[model samples]
Target chain A: MARLTLDALRTILVACAGEDDGVDLSGDILDTTFEDLGYDSLALMESAARIEREFGIALDDDDVNEALTPRLLLDLVNGSEVRAA
Target chain B: MSTQSSTAAGASGRRVVVTGLGVTAPGGIGTEHYWKALLTGENGISELSRFDASRYPSRLAGQIDDFEASDHLPGRLLPQTDVSTRYALVAADWALADAGVGPDAGFEDYDLGVVTSTAQGGFDFTHREFHKLWSQGPEYVSVYESFAWFYAVNTGQISIRNTMRGPSAALVGEQAGGLDAIGHACRTVRRGTRLVLTGGVDSALDPWGYASQLAGGLVSTVADPERAYLPFDAEASGHVPGEGGAVLIVEDADSARERGVERIYGEIAGYAATFDPAPGSGRPPALGRAAELALAQAGLTPADVSVVFADGAGAPDLDRAEAEAIGRLFGPHGVPVTAPKALTGRLCAGGGPTDLVAALLALRDQVIPATGRTARVPDAYRLDLVTGQPREAALSTALVLARGRHGFNSAIVLTTHRP
Candidate 1:
């Protein structure tokens, strides 16, 4: 049982950017636009795979696309936030 | 046999011309953006920041940035295909849009074809599939995994999505495969197909993909981003691998004339391709021979070309051979050689189409940018290397050259359309 930090989330975001720079996964969880940080559908799936392996979490591509962001990623890792959709 | 003065390839059918161009490049994702970035000499190469690239020898590459598959492909098709194929679909859609074709348009009704090429089709998908099969058992693998990794997936997907049934081909991208694909598409018109969607797509950013290049010793492993891949520079180590994939709108010249498509970006005037055999096996005469034959095929002389889009493998020995080949053709002087991918890294199958795009752009602008990362041309080269900033002149024709890493060298001639 390990804890996630802001630094770890940043690393994940940057790594995802390299693999699929087209996805918009950067900003806020609540109001962030889908096109802002480049997470298109395929990118969402690819990122979900990478996240599941890296954080030991099983996230569906649809869920990731719906709530993918730095703040949201941190909240999800800490179990502070629940999947809305 | 009433044909008088026609060859097999030349007399294939109606002449194909480029109507539109769309690209998802590392420097810029789309046409206007990428063309602007290219003209400004932006450096898209950097360390493989996507994964744990720390373990690999060649950590540097021209990685694509800010390009999401969702931005280019439909939502329903998302879960069905691999990243590479997704890239192909998106790029194809963009190209189609650029050409003024609708997404659900009846491309099948028009004699359209799709030909895409790549070296390792879907290494990313295969690598992940293998990992899953090992860890979670065989049942965990997606059914689409097998199709994703195949070489012809891009062409098949593009053809199906567009309903283009003319002729579907997935070239293995032997360097000349991109040129050959376009050439093959052009030939289809003679058999009655009016249009062809021909290009290549490759995204080798995964671990195994990086490792495969490591085995080849063709990548530059230097840590410094600016100094890593200096093609034609004496201090060059090796090339920086990049994400390469693009789609070109090619069609018959007569059809284009009939439709009254005004902007004749460029024409596939003449093409030549050959294999050099193995390296140190006494330099096969195929590339030079191909170049000469390409000139003859285009009904052109070496003097007709205003600039040369070099293969620019970034390998010292190969670069020298390419320079020698160009020198022999155009007389050891200023034919103006340019390699735009030096900044973006080699995209493998993506290389030729992107290069083709650059050649078309160069013809339109009448200026070719210098091969990025090179100020002083290598000692052995005698050809005029366009370096540092873009050069402008009255460009009429361009000779694009490519030599695949797997023993294929191809040259394509493109002529500018004035009227």
Candidate 2:
């Protein structure tokens, strides 16, 4: 498995939230919560599902709920990859 | 000249008037757009593109195009509801705003109510959820699925969102549900509630919804848009299924007057409902009985109704049964008949309320809009069906009719608000 770059992680987060180029999915907003980013629980659930499918990793329901910020979700993905390797 | 009791609430037998109307239909999104397109006799039927209908028996429907919920509703509502519910929310907003009430308005003090009817609620959403359950897993299903597709979701959601703590209810009478909702609201006001938000919203345009409707065998399979849904014509094949609805604010006449409501659309003069004979019962339908009973309730006779909005089911026997009923009541060409559903298709639960809006508009404008695509009334019927173009008349009272698939028949009478 390759390393998860910040840019790649940001792109994945953008696609997971079903957002287009209108949203600035960059490191500057990594600390922002999904709710602040205009993404509701349903949107975040869908984003988590897409992330799990793409990363070949299993995500816990509680983990998804606790990962309120984009950076937290990225950390979960990177941790899952490290464990897998 | 009347023995009806008049209370402080102005219960002249508890008179109820339609104070405001909101519509989202196939041709347009608002009431003005609906009435304009209706009067112009524009065709709203087209190929069903909401889902893959290539293999379905019925390929055509009155699908609403370019309906952006975000454009019509608030941001918070975007993720909470299905297309049908969103349509209902937008329509409710229009109705409340039209009635000079809102979420923060002083209407909260009054006994306000809501009754939204639907035969098929959250069908598209349910279909999507079922697909998720089948293809993915139960865990993938939306949490909103539990209430989204429930028949009462509209009533519940509308009541909660608007903070209407009065007697809220959901009517589940199939196509007659819309009229029955208003009928029930009228009765409720007569019993005591001051204001009622009532109407219907339905969308069955998805694969699962369309498949279920197709199994019912009443929808037109005709590929031609122009010849698909001819309600009263000899060439009438079958009805087209459409998605949309109308919401109306029905307030006690006295309350509206006290609130200084300037323009009351019309009074819900009378309403009656009856059942049709079973499919193989070998008996004529009782549509005329419902009409007569409704008219009698309004303290009116057959001669009083200025125009008739026929149920216009579009199936041969159904159309003939309705025509026979009109002939029996109106004495052969005595009343002008029109079925504007030819333009918007049969909206099931949504049709009755939509027709109510049309009837009120007809009363206001004194013009009966033509039935689209039905060039000729069948020769066997001695009814004066409006077609080709709209007809100008001294329209003061209108009769709107609706019939559900399984024996439900409803009639509602609306009279212009005479101050």
Candidate 3:
């Protein structure tokens, strides 16, 4: 299976909830928290829903909430097995 | 005999005036465009293009074809809000800019407030979420649905965006809710708030929203745009559903003058709302009572009003009731009456504020826009209905009326600021 790359995560984040004008997502943003990145909890939830649909993964709500950074979210997505429909 | 005034009379000493207006209606996006459309007697009702409305019986709507939300709002707000709320946010921005009250405008966050109305909330947003819940499971639904579909979402979003921490509220009287919102904001200003962003904006043209409107049984089924909605006419059947409305900067007159605001639209001189008696109660509709009380609150007689912006529900019984109320107050064909909604259809909660905007502009320009294409007026109705062409008159004061489905009736009187 292909891994979820940082570029793919950036695309999902911008597509789900727009990017903040002040925040630069192009640089090293893997360790930065979503709160500092200007994306609120609701925005993260929306991004998670979109990522789940695209990656064919079912993420636990609490687990998604705990994954607050891009690095963590990428690891979580790449580690999960594609659920059978 | 003097009319009995409601609690609205307590704020009689503190005058409230409209300083700025922002509109996103069917025919136009801004106040200038809207006014020009009204003057030219342009109609905005057309076949619904939001979705595949072919399956519905009543497919025509007063849709805003040119409003590209991306042009007016930021991308972050795009995902958070629905179409109706987007309209309101843009309208509020325009109104605040028009009033010259921005971040640097000296007014504190606590002095500015927002009081808006919406009948169905964000139907488009809610419908999409519901589809996900049924098809892709509950986890797929967006978290914004928690408040996005709420009727008070407009007020909340407007207040939050502008950081308006002053007295604010949200009303839901269906069509009458728009005027009710303005009236409440006037009261808030009288209590010493500096300014209030008031009025309403609503859009529910999606399949679910359209179905809800059809369930009301008040929508006209005629496919022709011109003949679909005719108010005060013998052939009046029902109204065509439409979307969008107006938002106004209602400020304390003294505060507005202190701020050096030059263009004052008009003073919100009087306002009153009343509930109708139960059906089959052998009692009359309270629309006339509401009008009389509003005029009395303004210390004006029926003759003082130069023109009337009527509700014009465009249904037989509703039209007759509104006409009778006008006749009782202004006598038979005593004052010029117009319902520009004939062009835009009934905009639900947005309808009343839109009419109020028309009244204020008419008072400013001394012209009454025609009731677009509603020509076959029944003589028995006794309304001096303005049709075909805009009527130029020496207008000073204008009376606006609105009635909701479940027995809500509201009346507001706007007079020239200098007068």
Candidate 4:
């Protein structure tokens, strides 16, 4: 079981954004879409891909696509499927 | 002005000449293969093999297969550097050799320059590091990871490895960084330098990088491999993403002549880069501006040119716009046009140099290879697209264009040894 902590989120955030200083990391990861968080679609995809490769688990598109908040992405990371609206 | 006068031509500069050529692209890992593949139109675009891209929106990409990194990097350094740096180092070695300036090339004290352009610098490493951090604790995050994938790292890596002390800079342009690298190198040489190793390489093969590109809507994710990267063709759905590398040995005319270098590949005759003043039609035929400026800088006219190396970005809006620009500037029939990149996929910052290599070789061999796989041109695109096999023609002057993914546009004019 992996610990879904802020530090872990920060690293992923920095990598996706292609830099470290933009997002409101001290608060939430899922509070925004890639665009709102200054993360483009490319950066988000990169972040998701690396997460999959690192965790050695097959993350489905819904798992990545549905997670919008930092808490939500972390929740999604742990295998909790996003609740469809 | 109808005249294609690049800023360099108007600046009153010393004649710039190319002394060496090197490449590590989809065409081939090295210059020879890079050129040969383009002539034969080998398709670099294919289904995603680097990662399991089954679920992604687009499965197609231009990936460089069989790139055995160990072949390029010695034992110790392989683990530390990113793939981007590895590609750049290998390309620089090839360019220096092609220029006839090896470790024993005799000028230890001479001032040399090195400039490389890149869009996504080290996505692979950054992606991996992020994964590690997620999988392990903060301690597991390699401290060096901070600098490993940054935008400016590759240029520094090449400069340090080559011991190049003169004029070293990197352009953080979108895709145009590749051709812009050449323009920068040309200007650096004109300002004075013995030789410059310049070009660009980009690898978005990693899943993270791939996703990033896919999300942008820039990549042609079509499942069918053949239809993935048809630039200038009506069937051109979208561009295939991939890696590309090219290195040029730029030098002054007098210096090259002094070394007794044989007939020059082509001179860095003119270069012009302009930003889109506004997004509308007034976006200024910025690319055309780049071309005209380049031609004018070379002291040549469109009538003097035999062929053109297009950007061929493949996005419909950009594609039609580019075609209209070319037909408007060069008049459809007169100047033969070709873009062998359809097979190699667009290399982003690396695309320009890859296209320039084809253009430079065309000047040397006088054959313009056709655009591969582009079976049909859009109705709006009226230019005579070089289709299927190569076009046999004597080329004395050539034009190469590159545009930043965001907005910057550049044009470089090449000419045979100007007597």
Please estimate how well model 3 matches the true structure, expressed as its whole-model Cα lDDT: 0.90
Candidate 4 wrong stretches, greater than 4 Å:
A1-85, B1-13, B280-285
Considering every candidate listed, which one attains the maximal TM-score? 3
Full candidate order by TM-score, most accurate first: 3, 2, 1, 4
Q: TM-scores of all models?
A: 0.80, 0.85, 0.95, 0.80
Number of the top-ranking candidate, with DockQ as the measure: 3
For residue B211, what is the lDDT in candidate 1? 86
Clashing pairs in 3: none
CA lDDT of every candidate: 0.73, 0.84, 0.90, 0.75
Which scores greater on TM-score, model 2 or model 3? 3
> What would the per-residue lDDT of candidate 4 be over residues A1-85, giving only the tens digit for each residue?
4655657776875754444234455565455555666554445555766676566555567667767666677777777433333
Model 1 alpha-carbon drift over 4 Å, by segment: A1-85, B1-9, B103-110, B278-283
lDDT of 4 at B148: 71
Candidate 1 lDDT for residue B137: 74
- List the candidate numbers ranked by DockQ, top first: 3, 2, 1, 4
Tens digits of per-residue lDDT for model 1, B233-319:
777678888886688888777776776666767878677667766657875557778777767776777787889888788778778
State the displacement of the C-alpha of residue A44, model 1, in Å, after optimal TM-score superposition.
Answer: 21
Ranking by lDDT: 3, 2, 4, 1
